[model samples]
Target chain A: MHGLPANLEEALLGLVREKLFEGGATLTVETDLFAAGLDSMGIMQLMISIEERFGVRVPESAVTRDHFSTASSLAAMVRRCAAPA
Target chain B: MKALSDSIVEAIFARAAEAPERAAFVGRDGEISFDHLVADVERWATVIARLPGFPAEGVARIGVRCPDGVQHTVLMLAVMRAGGCAVPVAGELPGDERSMLARTTALHGVLSQGGEERAADGSERHEIGGGLRWERLAAEEPCFPVEDFESVCPAFIRFSSGTTGASKGVVLSHGTLRERLDSANRRLGIGGTDRVLWTLPMAHHFAVSILLYLREGATVVLPEGSLAGDLLTAACQYGATVFYGSPFQAALLAAEASERDWPGLRLAVSTAAPLAPETAGAFVRRYGVRLSQGFGIIEAGLPLLSTTGEDPMVVGRPDDFELRLEGSGTEGGLCLRGPGMFDAYLSPWCPRQEVMADGWFHTGDLARWEADGSIRLVGRLKSVINVGGSKCFPEEIEEVLRCHEGVVDARVRGEEHARWGMLPVAEILPVDGSSPPTDGELSAHCRARLAGYKIPVRYQMVRELPRTASGKVRRV
Candidate 1:
């Protein structure tokens, strides 16, 4: 699974906007996933976005942190997944 | 901090060396032989041992994010072989959950594919605790061999779905690894010539049988896409004989196949959760495949083909473990014991005495023995939703609703109610393209199927029920 990093980031942002936020416009790097009302089930929608965006496997354990904590952490994790090893 | 036992990794190597040319792995990318796979593991093993922070001694637990396909198995086996425990992951979790489990476990190292553009220290090492990636670990490289290794050591730790709390790590013995592996192999009827579709996630023990597949020279089909279509397509494409899943996975597969036909399937083995009698019956009716539901957990070795008789609720008899019962009512806890079972949970281990009274590990499942000695699981004792002490089991309600003609799936979770304290609520998926059954119709249907108290007080119809990757309905 290979793809562009910027496109991956933009795709992730678009996903948070469309699937997560409904383009309501409040999502940012500092947004609190839990406090913002993104429950575990809602986090699953984010799981799909990361998978679709970077084409990498994010384990269920990852569901607890890095991705769901904040927008910046989520983006960094995604960028890591999208970044070529 | 390395919590796993040692023999698990040795078994992986033993299985690989036994079948060098056999199909060790199958992913969307392609197939690989056990011989080539071992070379890569050894190369990484050598690299891991010398890294500054990597554990060269003591019981060390490591996390690895393996994709749906490719040879993440190689990296894991290498770790175990080098006397390290392999913390298997779903490889599809979000970053936060991934980091949480990593930090919770404090994995010494991490192995991931396609994550890092460059290493933090410019070294090839990838930290497993956080999403620290290195540019070199993903390539096709051989793992270097460790000159000195501890054969008698912990391999990895697994999370147990606790009866009353969030899941905790369960420790297995490298001491009993071989015995456990053998029991699973015997039950699975696995061999080198038999190709296994690695449908279960990497963290599960059944993947230990992957070694058996290699020994027999059989190919493995590792699906890269969604597990939704992978099993069916692989059943036809790989001629999968022993299809494995939890009762829910079996039910979903049967439900999915209800609309189609699957002729290539040979054996349908259900574990993790008890397959409902109706779920089993439907699969046999549609595909003519008998659903083999059994019981398993991280602490105890998963036994095979346990059932009192032909009933799906009858989880057969324990092959490698022991069983016992406590309490009464339509619900009670099912306890188990045997050699392959772990002695106790590492943390606190306080509940050990209660759970291990009389050499049996109380499984906390509401079950009973039938006339023929088969175990019947009603549901989890703790999973009950308390509505002002009018105790209710969600599975019973969901089971009745799932039987509705227009309902393909249903989930019953307890929701906050001002007056009731907690009330049973449901979410449902209609059968095929038809409209979901009306709430009144469903409530009436449940009235006939369950006690008046068990009837759902509220419900909503939707395109699909929320489920985990393994197909179990998620409560929260």
Candidate 2:
């Protein structure tokens, strides 16, 4: 297999760790972002980071509490948006 | 001591009485009429008066800590209505910062809701109505002169940035607020038919925005969220005519996939921070409604607004205010002599006469005049970094960085950004030069101490930070 990243989930977790907060080390794919101190301001910053990292535009509608709950959920949303029409 | 005029809350009451049935606020929870709004404000004001340690004569300084909504608006107005100066304790402040604000302001009490917690130390917490609780701090002597504060009939005490260091507690008197509202409205022209879509936090922008809208008999449309979809939906449903928000929001709405053109939108203004030209361009292209740039500050109200919508940088001619450039040539520090200038600074007790002794309030912006006589901001003379509208000083961040044992010294600077006006970057001189503190360690330490936006985006290891001749850290 090619030396690509394991999955979108891991990439997003890496992003949350590097760009957003320091809780990335303790955070698993299923770790709750809100529990880890993700606030309204954090969500806005995370959205910008996701857009830059994934090379995709997340619609305002996609910014819901559920989709932003965990790294896994965010990766799923990113995958859905990044996929071809 | 100067004699006082009518309060802004009283003016709001008179305006509400003129047309009681009209909608004052239209939110996701439905519309609330002017009469209902007035009634709620009065009821809360009565409740505030009954609270223990409610001042018998002189004005009480009460901190308002609530989520951004109609309730927040009502409680602030109520505090003013009850003859207390309202201080907005921003929800983002850490516990220590909150304690600093409470101590510095010498607050008589704090009206806060659940979710955001500050320990009740030497203060009694009583459950106030409307899911709000009152933390009545034990009465203590304020650091500043109470008579000086009360003489101007103070309405609001707003802090520009962090509580520590060079933070200014800008005090805006009731008469000053009224005067500024009138002056600002000369350009805004918001009237009864207009419905303003509110997006910015009430804690930061209530004095000029929310108060002005209510005073002018306009309905305020409070959106469910800050997202483009929510804003658009609220705007369309509420017949919102005016859109006022930050450039970041304008960029988001511009990038939105929705094809529905909000035809009712008339005047869209981007304020709080500098508006990017790209954001202005995209918004105009998206909605066919030109975006105007507003130049507003804590010390001075909305004085300059770009009316022609030609350039985002050229925040248009002063509205009912006089402006001057401090230095000789075209480019210098922007200065203004205005009707609605702040009354005083709280902690040091500097009055208007002293601060404006030179007959001008020196704004820390470096600007140049265009051929058309419109002012265009080029740079800042101060070292404050504006991350998308929230401001943080370099010294504050450097202090936090220096707190880490590994850091010997640090310097933070605002690096120009394409999207956000600026992003903070740090240079740290480490104790062990061979093994400097990693980004993760620095970030984690900063995250615990400072607001997220104030935290430096990137950390660079250095042997030394440049210093001025006086041995002070050099800032560009």
Candidate 3:
């Protein structure tokens, strides 16, 4: 629910664009990841990449359709999870 | 080979009574014991019994919109226990498509997820427990009187995945379903000692696999997430013996950098899509297990299986069905006739006789027999692309494209070319969005795996390909 830092959002979008979409796909922070063909497997790969890169663990409960709806939303969730409790 | 009950509900009850404390299904949320599963089924059956349109005697057809997990499994069993045919509708379907299925099936009621129940014009609504709402729709218009097919009692009505075009309901009777489970189990050898790691949507494969697993008293483990790491962990932790997944899932697993051998994995079966030799080889190389393929059709239940896993392309021999190649040479239309075939089609209420010609169901698949007497699937007849008097199968080309490291999924279709009758064009989904192989790189990869004529002339990279509710790429 917390917003992601500007740099973090850019990094997350870049990762998604690279891993889930083709280089030719034009992705923005507002672009719907699911609409762009981000399926369950894609989300899993994204979560793994995010964890490896940012050290944030996304709980299974946090992996709903809404959380991964867009690059911005996913970045926000990743940021929230990564923040100190 | 044993004396199994004809009714799935009866089999479930028997298993529950035999092993009350045994785990029936293990999901991310929690595990359900056989006793708990039976109790849940009874409670939902009581709710169905009180529904308005549920018939007092005969089997009532009801639609269910529930996600794939313990809840969906329970609800389906409940529908069967209540003497109704369970129609499993995908929860993610658009409202229009859902309503169309309800209308076409002439469902007596639909049990959908969420808190509240609303009924429009000709339907009445009631709230069932467990966040499920039941609505009774008006009866379908009388076109022809409903007649029983071969005196077999109907149990489940499943709509085709509709990867190619319009979906049709394939009705399976209780007897037919039981027969399918028995026949497939003989080949699969799943039993009480086995635990299956399930990932495919329950709605798409319930009758053939999930229901069959339960009937055979095997434990089913549903992974918490689709992550390859999570699934591999679940399979190892739960001691899964059999793994049922799609080619995409297998590719993901093959890509994961897991060092430990998946200790308990005895069998890995791929369905719903073609199994690329690259995928099969990678999985076997990574895990030391062959990824067997099964050629399953909604009309005929799991007729062929690669039990030996010797050749990934060879789908092995028929179990219960009598398979025949209808044409000549190495390529011909695959036709089958067997027990446990679909009893009827829902919309027009056409009997099986209407569709069958001399007891053979002409599956739209193009296949050929190997020298070893196993059937190797070429592709779907409708998906063949002819180029300059030569023919090629899209599945063959797509498999080559998928073998590329940068490609995640590929769909090949024919384009109208002025010179060649039809030229094959491909839309590729990159493995990771950042770097996809260029057209030249993909062409080179294809050249290594396929003949020159089979390579796609053009390639378009996309983020994702359109898919059906069942997760197969929708070829439009």
Candidate 4:
């Protein structure tokens, strides 16, 4: 609820934060999430959460952590992938 | 590094002695309590120790086949107790290789569910497995004087085919074991309440993490076999809270969630290889859980990514070790620096210099760093196929092939040609048992998803593509 976008980003961030907090980190958007903390395994969860929450099918190419590195990038990705208007 | 002392065995013995009726291991064969398991170990370890030839240093070089179901865990601890090494062997390999491995380690003994006797020198044959019996050596249990070992003492050894085509032993020290266990235990919040599903054999480092969970008194449920449906049933039956496997296993679970009952699983972890986007998304949609992928090779320790599911493609961050991508230009490689990395491959041919240049262990995988700096594995460098002048990583193309609705599996390999030098070949495995997708259909599928140069020039509709023992699509 606090970061990213609505329920979609919320669910995504919630899972992200669980791992972030597990390592006792305070991660925000634009943070070098993958390099700073997020790992390959975390990306799998993020993609799963975004699709489940927003009902969007994220292309495998787009799921790379590079797209989600920053809050703005992740938010932009969500806006693009969320089902049509 | 923590030593395998009399204390661990004492704890199991105390638990069993305290509550002889408490369930120790439970599975399809019914539940065997602490009393039964310990009693068996107490009876077996003595015979195991006396088997004449268990090497002196590391306790038990005891190899078990495909794992003897769940009872193998107790047997492992007991072997550790009797000052023996516990070697976990994956049954996916050919019988010849498995047999060679048993003899290569100078095994003290070999155990399996049902098999004939292996002629091991000095080592006695303690047939815990059902069926055919061999003549037992003297059943006298030797009194073991618990000896503390250095961090480098060989606690267990796993055989993996490294850069060389042949299998090479990767020995892990007790320190590395404890380091990984402690890191995963504390960082992942995996403890007594966690019951993990073991789809892969415990002999590998991926399975090594399960031992960490076990030390916390957690339950590990082994899959019935490779079938995803069977795995789902085991997860539900064991009330498994966590699941782990290679990307393929995770994908299959996601692909077939509705067919299997998996309501209790809270965590689904993917490792060993790249996790397809479909696999990650399907699992989350069906189970409301994330199928997290982690970065680790044979040399590096089992690195954990964060739980924060931010992006599917990003490998997330480094774990107990540091991950660095080296070599600039087109040929650079991935490198890892941390405690979990092995000291060296057992092969003395190159020492550790080939992979571990300086302090970093070069991972043959290459990737592009995202803006957030998360890593994405493109594919093995060796698997890169040259399409005319341009370079195409097979994983990129394979991902496209997997996205097709009817395509269940796909393998992209570089094949030599008289004109093109090398062309990409696409091998598709259909969802149904029928023939594979046609060339035109596959072409159309690729034309939509890939670049002009990335598409395969030739398509082969084969019943199956060759795969490694662990089920990875293999290419020369």
**Best of the candidates, TM-score:** 2
In model 4 chain B, the worst 10-residue window by lDDT is B142-151
What lDDT is reached at residue B204 by model 2?
79
User: Cα lDDT of model 1 overall?
Assistant: 0.57
Error of 2 at B183 (Å): 0.5
* Candidate topping lDDT: 2
Order candidates by TM-score, high to low.
2, 3, 1, 4
Instruction: Write model 4 residue lDDT over B1-476, tens digit each, in one string.
Output: 12435333444455456556645455554666656776677766665566555555545566655344555665566566666556665533334345556655555566554434333334455444334122222222322222322234555666643433334566665555666555555446775566777765455443346456545555656655444566677788878888877664565566653455578888777765555566677778778888776654555555646465545556666656676667664325767777655544543323344546687766666766656656666655566554322345677678878988778888887776322335677788887757566655665566544434456656666688888999988875
Give the DockQ-based CAPRI class for model 3.
incorrect
When 3 and 4 are scored with TM-score, the better candidate is: 3
For all candidates listed, what's the TM-score of chain B alone?
0.67, 0.96, 0.77, 0.67
Best-to-worst lDDT order: 2, 3, 1, 4
Give the residue spans of candidate 2 off by over 4 A.
A1-40, A47-70, A76-85, B1-5, B119-122, B161-165
Instruction: List chain A TM-scores, every candidate, in order.
Output: 0.73, 0.86, 0.86, 0.67
lDDT of 3 by residue, B1-476 (tens): 11225668887688768878889988685888888888888888888877888877566878887767888888898888887889987643434346667777777888877523232235687766677788888877534245563255778888734222234577788888878877777778888888999877677678878888888788999897665677888888888999878765776677665555788988899876667677788889888888888877777787888977767668988757788887667789888887778887765666778878577888777899888778988756676564432345677678768878898999999775432346678999998777778866776566544434455766888988999999988886
- Candidate 1: where is the Cα deviation over 4 Å? A1-85, B1-6, B92-100, B115-152, B204-218, B255-264, B307-309, B327-331, B349-358, B383-476
Give model 3's DockQ, 2 decimals. 0.08
DockQ order, best first, reads 2, 3, 1, 4
lDDT score, candidate 1, position B463: 76
Tell me, by DockQ, which candidate is best: 2
lDDT of 2 at A64: 64
Per-residue lDDT over B1-476 for candidate 2, one digit per residue giving the tens place of the 0 to 100 score = 11223889988988899999999989775789999999999889989988987778789899999878888989999999888899998776666567778888899999997653662356788887789999999877788998888898899999855222467698999989999999899999999899999888777788789999999999999887666777888999899999999888887788765767888999999997898888889899999998999998888888899988878988998657888998799999998888889999887778988988999888888998888888999988888888888888898789889999999999999899767788889999999998889887887788766666777877889877889999989886
